[model samples]
Structures are given as C-alpha cells and as structure tokens.
Target: MSLSAASRPELDDTLAIRRRTLTLGLLTLTYFFSYMDRQILAILVELIKADLKLSDTQMGMLGGLAFALFYAILGIPVARLADRANRRNIIAVSLALWSVMTALCGLAQNFVQLLLARIGVGVGEAGSSPPSHSIIADLYPVEKRASAMAIYSLGVVLGGGFGTMIGGWLASQYGWRVAIIAIGVPGILLAVLVRLFVVEPKRGLSDAARVADSSRMPSIWSAFADMWRNAAARHLVLAVTLTSMIGYATSYWGPSYLQRSLGFSVGQVALIVAPIAAIIGTVSGVGGGRVADWAAKRWGIHAQSWMVGLLKCAALPFTILFFTTDVPAVAITAYVFNMLFANSYLGPTFAMLQGLAPLRTRAMWAAITLLVINLVGLGLGPTMIGVLSDALTPLVGKEESLRWALVVAVSATPWAIFHYWRAGVMLKRQQEMAA
Candidate 1:
C-alpha cells in the first residue's frame, strides 16, 4: 500500500528522531576518546618530562601549544568542508586519523617525534567537534539545544577522567607508551562503527518552517560575516576564549602543582586528582546546562545570563582560595568547585552560538569560534603560565613560581564574565530582531 504525502512527512519525522539519537550517541562517544587522548599527557607529564629530559616550557609546548596550534589553524578549512560536504563522513574519517596519530605517539622515541605525533593528533581532532555541533543543531529544536549539547559536553569530563585513571594505571604498571597505545586503538574500531551506523539528519529538520531553507546555505566567508554581524555570537566567543584560558591553565598545571606542593607520586596524583576532578567536572558540566535551561524558562532572561552571572560571582573567591591554601584537602575542595564553575559555561555558550549561526553555516561558525577559543585559550593559557613560571623561578623558586602564575592566570576569569554578560545583552537584541 502506498502512503499519502501527509503520512510520509510523519513517517520521515519519526525516522529522523531515531537517526539523530544514534548519530549523537556515537559522536559523543567518539568525542570522549578524543578528549582522553588529548588529556592523557596531563596525567603522565612527569614521566614524559623525565624520560625525554625536557623542561617545563618544552612540556607545555607539547601539551598546550603544539597540538593546539595545528588544531586551531586547520579547524577552519575542515569545518568549511564539513559545512558543505558530508559531515558524517568527515567525522568518521577524522576519528580514524586522530586515532592512528594517537597510537603513533606510543612509538615516539624522542621529544621531537612525540611532538610531531601530537601535531598529527591535533590535525585529526580539528575535524570532530564543529561537524558534530552542526549535526546536533540539525537534530534538536532551539529550546532543547543547550540541554542536548550539555549531555555531549560530558565527554570532556569522561575523557579526562578515563585518561588520568587508565593512562596513569598503565604508565604505573607498564609504561607511558603502552598507555598511549591502549587508549588510541579503540578509536579505530569506533570510527568504523560510526561510518557504519550513523546517518545524517536533514539540516534544520527540527526548526520552524520559516527558519528552515535548503537554499539558504551560505559560503564559508559569508558564514563568518554572519557571525560578525551577530553581537551575541561575538561576545560569546570572546568570553568563552578568556575563561577557557583560566580553565586550561589550571587543568594543565594542577597536576604539577599537586606533585610539587603535596609531594604526590605520579600514580598517587592520578588516583586522587583525576577521579575527583572528573566526577566534579562531569556533574557540574551537565548540571550547568540544566541550570541554564531552568533559569531561562523560569525567568524571561537569556540562558547566557545564568551562565555568565554564575561565573562572575564564583571567579574571585575560588581563585584566591585555590592558590593561597596550603592544605591539600582544602586545595582539592577549592579545585573541585573551580573546575565545576569553570566548566559550567560550556553548554550554554555553544548552544547560544549554534542558535545564532545560520543553519547552513553552523559547522563553520562553530569551527571559527573553536579556533579563537583554542588559539587564545588552549594555545596560550598553559604556555603563558609556563613562561611566568620560568621567569619567576629565580625570584620565587620553581614551586612558588607556579603558584604565583596561577594567581595571575585566575584574573582572566573576571574578564570572561564580562564578555558573557555582554553576550547576554546581545542575545536579547538578536531575539528581538528574529521576532
């Protein structure tokens, strides 16, 4: 029996929902591994440093700038392809590329080789998130988008946690190389699964008829222009970049701080800090998304208000408490809250950007925003602290240099809050224009 056109639309809608769920789930899992590979170095920093006979600056370059530089610079072109081409294929291929590169990191015999391998990993990872964001925007309606994105952002916490726990255990038992290989290999199989199982959904499938238009797709340059015109997008990207500087600085250096100040071994530091930070970060990341949603619904305010306001209020005290406290238990408690608060911005900010970007340009816009965030945040944050640490070493000693560097880094958090607030105001204006 042939179905009527009306019946066909309904059938298509049902199928789209199922496909979207499958696609999002697979993408999120893939992201989890990507994050794990990126962060495993944090847990194994001391071992890698000693084995390679490297300085703090060199380790910072490997973990922070080397990967981030390529990742940031290459993201735009890849995202342009993702915006116009087959995003599912882009993501699958990207997963495979990064996975292989990660495994190659295990084979690196020297600092240069490892650095080059990491650059490869960065190139591959540059392809994952922007396409995933665009695809997810296609799947969910505007109102529910933040919550959906939040769920996906949980990969960050899961990846970091697993990397620390698993990477640490492997390094402790075997070696760092084995840890790298173990984490890298699973992504290959997962990449195959992604290509086989995930189907792309129609762009703007969940939006109102007025907002969905196949012919409205813009060029990559046009997409960037659109983002520039949207004040909310501009402010959101700036705020996210600034806050990310603080967050990256802390996450990258916190392990070393613990090792120096608390005198924890590599294995012990992994056991204590990794699980605690992971649990707190994951819970807060997810909870932040929900809170933003809740706040938006209950008050007639933009979700950015809830996001930015929370950050501003929490930044100063958390910074002061975290750096100044000498007690490990107190420090950990402070660090947990800091991680939670810092990560809270992830879901709301991304959701806002996705909303502002034209449907056809979602991936490109997301990629551009990521480029800025990583270049400024990941690329510079840790390196800045390392520079500060090195410069202050003679005056304050190595340990105190790190401590003072953190204190200086935390100052960026307030700047992030201001941008977020500006984004909130712009969001209101954009909403009115859309209306």
Candidate 2:
C-alpha cells in the first residue's frame, strides 16, 4: 500500500540516495565500455587505413561524422523513451546491442564494413548518456550533482586510456581485429550486471517534496517546450555545441597529428600519448566536479559560470602552445592541460541542465541538448577538419595543413565562454524560481 504523504518524504529520500549511488556506479561502468569501444578505432587507425587503402579524410568520416550522424539523429527519440519507460532496461539493452556491433568491427574487410559497424556502435552509445543523466539528476540534490557527474565522467578518461593501452598492445601483438574483439566482449557481461542490480529511483527524489505537488509526469512535448522556453538552456546548449566542436575536432585529429608530424608509430604514440591524456583527463574531470560542487555551495549557483570561465581562460593559451611549440615535452604538456580544461565542462554543465529542466522532462531535455551537441559538434567537427586538411594539403602540404587546421579549430573556445556566462545568470533565475 502507498504510504501517507507526510511519511513518504523520509522513506523516499533514504531509498532514493541508495538507489542513486548503485545506479550511478552501474552507469559509470557502462560508460567505461561504451567509450572503450568508441576509442579503439583511433588506436587502430593505422592498420585500418593501410588495410582499407583509405585516406585520412575517409578515416575521419568513419571515426566522426558517419557514426555521429546516426547517433545524433536517434538520441532524442531514445531519450524520450527513457523519460517515458524504464531507463534501467533501456541501458541494459543498449549495452548488449553496442557490444555485439563492436565485435562486428573486428570482421570488417573493407571501409564500408567498418563504417557500418561504427554506425551500429554509435546507435548503441546514443542510448546511454541521456537516460543515465536523468537518473543521476533524480538521485542527487543540485548541490551534490556536479561531483557525482564528475565521478561518472571519469569513465571517459579511464576508458580512453585502457582502450589505447590495451588496444595498442593487442594491435601490436595479434592485430587490430583482435583488439576490437577484446574491447567489445566485456560490455555484454556488464549489461547483465546492470540489469540485475540497478533499481530506478523515483523522479526528483532529492528535491524538496514541494515539487511533487505539481504533476508527477509531464508529456514529452510539454517538457521539450519548457526547455525551449528557458533562455539559459538555449544559450548553454549553444556554448556547449561550439566548444564541443573544437574539442571533438581536436580529439579526433590529435593522434593523427602526432603520427604525421612526429613520425610516431601506432604502438609508440599509443603508449606515449594515451597514458598522459587519460591520467590527466581523469584527474581533471574528477577535480573539476569537486571544484564545481564546492563553488556552488560556497559561492552559490553561479559556480558553473566560474568553473567555465576558468576553463576558457586556461584553454586559450595552452591550445596555442600545443601547435606552435616544437618541443615534444612542451607540446604534450600543453595538450594535457588542454584536455584537462576541455573536459571540465562535462559534469557541471550536465548537472546544471538537469536542475533547469522540470522533473518529468529531464531525460527528454537532456536528449535534445545532446542531439544538438552531437549533430553540430560530433557530426561536423572532425569532418570539417578533415576537409580543411585535404584542401590545404595542396597549398601548404599535409603537415602544415593539419597544424593550421587545428589552430583554426581551437579558436572556438571564446564563443563557448560567452554562452557559459549567460547560462550562469539563467541558472540563478531558475534557482530562485525553485526556491
């Protein structure tokens, strides 16, 4: 029997916290494999390019836009499902689907086959983050959410590192095909673990019970309309999309840059670059989350604005240094800092978006934001860089073309900063309304 309204608050709060932690941990592991499967292709790029006789441009397509096109297009619908249905099951099914497709990448005999396989991977991964975000928002109070998300975001760095370290050794020892299989198989097992353990928390369990007085569930269309009505979310989406364009473009091309410019072999670059990038990225992601949490508590809701401001300021010079400096040590150092700053946004921005969205539409709003972010950022970033690199090759040669392309790409940082500042102001208004 349902509890009396007065007694439900304490019961729900206690149960919600427990469920949030369990589910968040499960989702984090899910992300670990999701990212590993996605990034394995980068480590294996040399072998694939050589075998398929594909140009760098084609590799960029396979890695970035081709997969991202499906991922971006499908994310919103799937996210809407998460809002309406059981998110735990959505994650479970998605995990298994992506794992099988990742294994299929091992069997690809040509670029077309690999492209199709990557597209499948994209479709599966698209199902993960939005639902996970919605769950986390319901689990944690606004003050604690950035750190929670920061911890969750660690999966990206760890996954990237492991994918590179393991993918590198496996590719070096057996072949690229075997590397793909090794990374893909583990995720299927994790799917079962998630389905068994994660319990869905009541939506908005951490917030004051006053919010429950409103409709418990809103329609997806109403939720989407609410998100659109918020100027802060709109501006934040714009900023994130622009910054992500720069970030994704650089991430896609950076390994290639090292190989082309520095003459590092696949094994060599993987060993040298992956560890550094992963370690720094993981640390920064967690650290940024903590910092955002602290700032929100001490400085108030404008904490995200401060966090974004610091990242933008830090990123500008380091990005410039990354390309212009000839010293490997200096360049790598710059790159490490660039990644650290670039990734700091993931936890804070996501937490803030959830805070802004009405409880019922949280998942849908997340999906809509991701749809724009992925379509604009993931879909175009690398492909644009690839096209520019190819076009500039005739004029400046491949090495210089890539360098210049990166320089142009890095210029998007300032735009990201402007929109983040606007989001902060909007967040204050939102918090006031909630109060």
Candidate 3:
C-alpha cells in the first residue's frame, strides 16, 4: 500500500489507511446515488403506467432499453477518457449530470419526454463506473481486490434498497413524480463532496508487477478485441453477461410481479423486497469476496472461478421456486436463498476481471464489460420479459404472464454456469503453464 502511494511520502501508513477508507467511502456513496437514481423508477412502474395510461412494454422500454442504450454505448468513450484524464472530475461531472436528469424524470408528462430524460441519466451514468472501478483497483492489490470491490458494490444493494423503499413510500404518500425528484436531486450534493474530498490515486499502484503502459491511448475496439482474445476473459464476460441478464430482468420486474400477481400494493411490495433483499445481498456480496479471496490463496485462482460457477448452479432451485410459487412464505423463503447465491457472484467476478485486465486497459475493459452486459442484460432482459408477457397474456392470462416471464428469465442460469466453469478450466491451464 505504501509503495503505491509512495508519491505522498509525508503521509504515514495510518494516514494512508484513513485516506483509502475515505476514498472508498466517498466512491461508495457516489455509486449508491447512481443506483438510487436509476432504480427509483422500478418502484414507480405501476403508478407511472396507470397515470400515463401506458402498457407494460412501454414501461419496460422506460426502465430498461432506453436508459441502457445510452448508458452502455457511451461508456466506452467516457471510460477511454477516464483511462487518461482526471478520473475524479469525470465522476463528479457524471454524477451531477445524471442527478439533474433524474430530477427531470419527475417533470415528464408523456412517454417521449420521460424516455429522453432517462436517456440523459444513462449518458451521465456511463462515466461513473469504469473510472470508479479503475480507482478501486489502483488502491487495493489483487489479493485484497474482491473485498474492496465488494465494499464498492454495497452501493448497488444499499442504493437499490433505499431507492425502492423510499421511492415507494414517497410515491404512496405524495406521488411517483415527487419520489423521483426527491431521490434524484441529492446526488448533486454528493458530487460536490466527491470533487472536494476524493484524491485521485496513481494508476496501477496496487499491482505487484510493474505493467508497462503506453504513451498513446488505444482505441476502444483495439482494447476490447485484445481482452476478448484472452480465453479466460472471454468466458468470464459471457458468464457475467448471462448473469446480468437474469439480474436486471428480475430487479426491474420483481416489484411489478409482487404487486400484479400476489395482490400486494406497490408500497407493500417495496417494503417487503427492499430491506430483506438489501440485507441478504449485502452480507452475501461481502462474504463472497472474502470467500473468493481465501479460495484463490488456498487453492488457486481457478478454484475461485469454480466457486462462482458452483454457486450459480446452487441457486437454480431457489430461482425456480421464487418465480413459480405464489405462497408468500414459500416464495419469499425461496427468494432469500436465491439471493444468497446469486449476489455472491458480483465481487469474485469483478476481482477476476480486474486481475485479467491489463493496466493501461483497465477502464476500457471495465467499460466493455458494462457495454456488453448492459446492452444485452439491461437493454434486452426486461424488454424480453415485457414482450414475452404480452405474448403469454392469452395463455397465462395478463396478470400471471409476468410471473411466467420471470420464470423464463431465470432459465438462462445453466448457460451462465457453463461459461464460468469454462473460465475455471482456462485458468487451470494457465496455472499449469506457470508451474
């Protein structure tokens, strides 16, 4: 840690630890707002649909495709900039842009206006994650990266939790518009805090080996192609893409399913899903990182990859039960188990991606992963469910169609499991060569 921050010779180890904690904490807050801004819409889905007289497909487009297209596509160029520019500035500006756009979402009276606002929010968010990921990697060494990444990822769970819980309560009390505006505006203040407090770290600071970086920046295509050519990275990306497809679909639609099928109000669904899911996701996410780090050291990195694969497979039964069963007790119990295993993949997967990515290409690699996953997962997953629900309406009846569509979404886990296992195999081959 001292070697990485050697430029700041005045700061002792204790101060360094304190600064690192502060940086991670601020980044986590930034991330928390990002998710909160994006996810608050999910809790408002039913209310928005009813007020605007919109269909499920339109709601899906609002929540998923429109936002994801800009978010995923622009991540590359913005991340390329982060690879070279002052990443802290990029993150600060990005947060402010998205926060304003999120506030704009409350003002929209129709589909096009809201869609454009969500797109603006997406454009802003495109700049946040890659830089943030690169920063965390620079601070935390590979051995400690899973836990570090897990800490950062807590933003996702916490933000999602509060976004839904708060959004729902506010929507129920005031209106969806007020809930959205209220949630979105606070991010600007957080952005100010970030720019003032967070000191940008030197890139590649945490790596044990000195990776040679070039003076010239590589094009996004070139960088992404280089990562894809690596077998482990290729498989890992596929696995994550598949898993995200499952995740985004469920998260975007889960509340709707609860409200529509199970006869719960939006407020009730949000209350039930938010706290428990957040708590479970938090514990599992952090624990997964600890377990993966230990597994990598005890056995090998290959063992860590295998662990991700096995856990996804383990979640299959619960995934089925969570979607299929209507009984609240049985269904919620199944959801908890599914979340335990499902959320576990995040830290281990990201840590492995960071380890595999080249120093110069870290931000680009992170962006490309987001691009592929969001394009497929966020862009298509919920949309597919919407389209499928529309198609299945005749067969299952309109209300039950969403539940069935969610069932279909979870079916892709086996395919994701295959890629993770293949990544483990590829890692083992590399380990053998090194030995």
Candidate 4:
C-alpha cells in the first residue's frame, strides 16, 4: 500500500501524500490487472484459432473489434457517470465485471460465444480507464503529471509482460481455456481491495482550484466540442489514434509472427517478449514521461509533443527492420529498439491529453480520447492487419502475409509523427496568442 514506489512526498500535498500515493499505486495495480486480463488472449491466439477453426480475421475481431467497439462506445457514458459518481466504486465494479467476463472467455465453445465474451470484457473495461485518469489528475499537478502518469503506464508494460508469459506457460501445460480461467479469478479479490482502500480525491484538488458544481456540469456534446475546438487536443486525437493502430496490430500479431516466421515457440515468445517488454518497455514508458516532463520544464509544455513525436519517428525504422528480417536474432533485436521508442509516447501523450481538459470534464475528455484510441486503434488495428494478411495470402502464402501486413501497419507511423510535430507547433502558437 506504500506508494513510495510511485511518488515523493514533497511533490504532493504533505498532509495527505501517503494516502494519495497509495491510491495511485492501487490504481496503477488495477490498470496492471486490466491489461493482463485483456492481453492474455494474444498468447492463446493459435490455440483458439485451431480449436474454433477460425480465420485470422475472426481472431482479429475477437482481439480487437469485438472488445474495442463496446469498450470505446460505452466509456463515454461510464465516464459521464464517473464525473458525478464515486470513481473508486466505478473502477471496482468494472474490474469485477471484466474479470468475470474474462473467465467466461475460457468457457466459450464456439466463435460466437467467444466473441460475445470478449465484448462483455470490453464493456466492463470501458468503465475503468476514464475514471482512473480523472482520479490521477486530481492527485497530481500539471508539473508532476507526466511522471505520475508514466509510473502508471508502467502497469500496462508489466501487466502485459506477465500476462503473455503466464498465459503462454499455462496454455502449454494445460489448455488455453484453463489458462484464461486461472488468470481471471484473482482480479475479483483485487476488486474487493480496491473498493475498500481507494479513496476518491476531490475534483481539482491537485490544482488547488474550485470543483465545478454537478448541477451545472457541461453536456457531453459540450465536452466533445471543447476537445475538438482545442487545437492541441485535436492533434493529440489524430496522433494517438494512428500510433495505437499500429501498436495494437503488432502486439496482437507478434506471437503468430514469431511462431510462424521466426521459429519461436509459444513458451519461447513468452520468455523473450516478457523480459523485453517488462524491462525495455518500462524504460520507454517511464522514460517518455520523464523526458516529457524535463522537456516541458526546460523548454515549454509544447516541447513534450516534439519529444514524443521524435521518439515515435525513431521507432519506424526498427519496426520495418523487425518485420522484414528473416533472421530471428535480427528480428528480435530490432523488436527491442522498436518497443523502446514505440512505447515512449503513452505516458507523455496521456498526461498532455489530461492537461488539455477542463477540471469538470476531465473524465469526459479521457473517455473521448480513449474512444478514438480504441475505436480506430484497438478496433481496427488488429482487424485491419488480419484482413490485409488474408488479402495477401494468395500472393505471399499464409505465414509470410502476416509479416507484410504488420509492416504496412507500422509504416503509417510517419503520418502520426507529422501530427505530433504539428500539435507542438499549434500548441506553441496557441500559447503565444493567449499570452
């Protein structure tokens, strides 16, 4: 419960720093659990595909669109509730719901059944993130937000690492179904801990600003309009959407790529990818935020966008190299740098997006941002890759086609880079005009 891992007392309200940081740790841990539940399916893809006799497109739908559609759509309304309700409770309930749904995934016998279960998982997960983002905003000021958020983002890296590793081992020892069931049950206990220990912070508490009255809360449309009107937010939407599209695609398909093209087994992938993802991913995820914070403090807030963009751009070459290479060592090595640079944007990008919102509508903005990221990124990313692979199968054969699809997915990073740089320019111009 000690949040010392995530915070320094001096950086927060001295009176309640311990309590607040502990809450952050719990929230971070919860995010970890969520990713673990969500991504375990990736490791089981081949097993599930064989068992159900499904296509790459169907698996992609299960992994991406099935879950992402409801997850993205329902988040807005759930976030609307969070802005007025108890955020801690919302998260707890969400965790419980999704955990149950994940367990249900193990029970499904057919593609349709599995698809519905995944959808249920998405629907449940939809409630967790927006409220968590809003809560984090209330716990840390703008100056420290990127760092705090980076710390939080480490959950995704670490959780995903553990998920794939454990999921793979479990699938190998038992079946994929048992593996899913085993991981799904623990979150129920954690959900209970969350309901008890996590205290909701007052809105605007970190910023030392007045909390808006609920009676005069802005309409959801008004919140959307604000984000659209804000030049920085608009660019962030495009940049994040594009970056995540490729990210989800590669992550979902990387195991298949390794097993099919590079000759790694499920267990080998788990071992290799887990450490790289845990260690290098940690570096990138946390480093991005620290770099952004340092850049923003030294140069200006707009500098954060530039740093994030450059990091993203650096990943493109490695991505291309990884997918194109036939040598396992070269491919694995390329993937390391690819993850390093590719993952660096999440914390800084999320912190910036949170900062872009008005206090009353922070949850709404988070939901909207997540909606785009999930809908375009999660919803289409893997699905697009699958469809593309299917389309290319006649030309390249089954396994090799996936490699090209992922390569094409990552090739779009340059366009995202342009948006990130353009965002920085627009942010600087906006600030100057306001001043």
lDDT of each: 0.82, 0.83, 0.88, 0.89
lDDT of 3 by residue, 187-207 (tens): 999999999888777677778
lDDT digits (tens) for residues 1-435 of candidate 4? 468845653444454455778888889989998889888888888899999899999999998999999999999999999999999999999999999999999999999999999999999999999999999988888899998899888888888888898899999999899999998989999899999888777788788655555668899999999999999889988998999888889888988998888888999988877778889999988888888999999988899999988887788888899999999989889989988988978788889888878888899999999999999999999999889989999999997999999888988999999989988998888778878
TM-score, per-candidate, Cα-based: 0.94, 0.93, 0.96, 0.95
Task: Order candidates by lDDT, high to low.
Answer: 4, 3, 2, 1
lDDT of 1 by residue, 1-435 (tens): 466865876676677688877877898898899889887788777788889898878778887899899998899999988877888899999999999999999999899999999999999999999999988888888777887888788788889887888998899999989999999999999999999887777778777753654685677678778888878788888888887787778778877777876667778777887898778888887888788777767653465565655665675687678787888888878877777776777777888888777777888899999999899898898888888888889998976888888889986676777787888887777667777
Clashing pairs for predicted structure model 4, backbone only:
none
* Per-candidate RMSD, Å: 2.3, 2.6, 2.7, 4.5
For model 4, what is the error of residue 294's alpha carbon versus the real structure, in angstroms, after optimal superposition? 0.8
**Could you tell me how far off, in angstroms, the CA of residue 237 lies in candidate 4 after the best superposition?**
1.0
Candidate 2 segments whose C-alpha is farther than 4 A from its true place: 1-16, 209-221, 429-435
State the weakest 10-residue window (summed lDDT) of model 2: 209-218
Model 1 residue runs over 4 Å out of place are 1-13, 433-435
Sort by TM-score, top down from the best: 3, 4, 1, 2
Candidate 3 achieves a global lDDT of 0.88
User: Model 4: residues >4 Å from true position, as ranges?
Assistant: 1-16, 209-215
Residue 378, candidate 2: Cα error in Å is 0.7
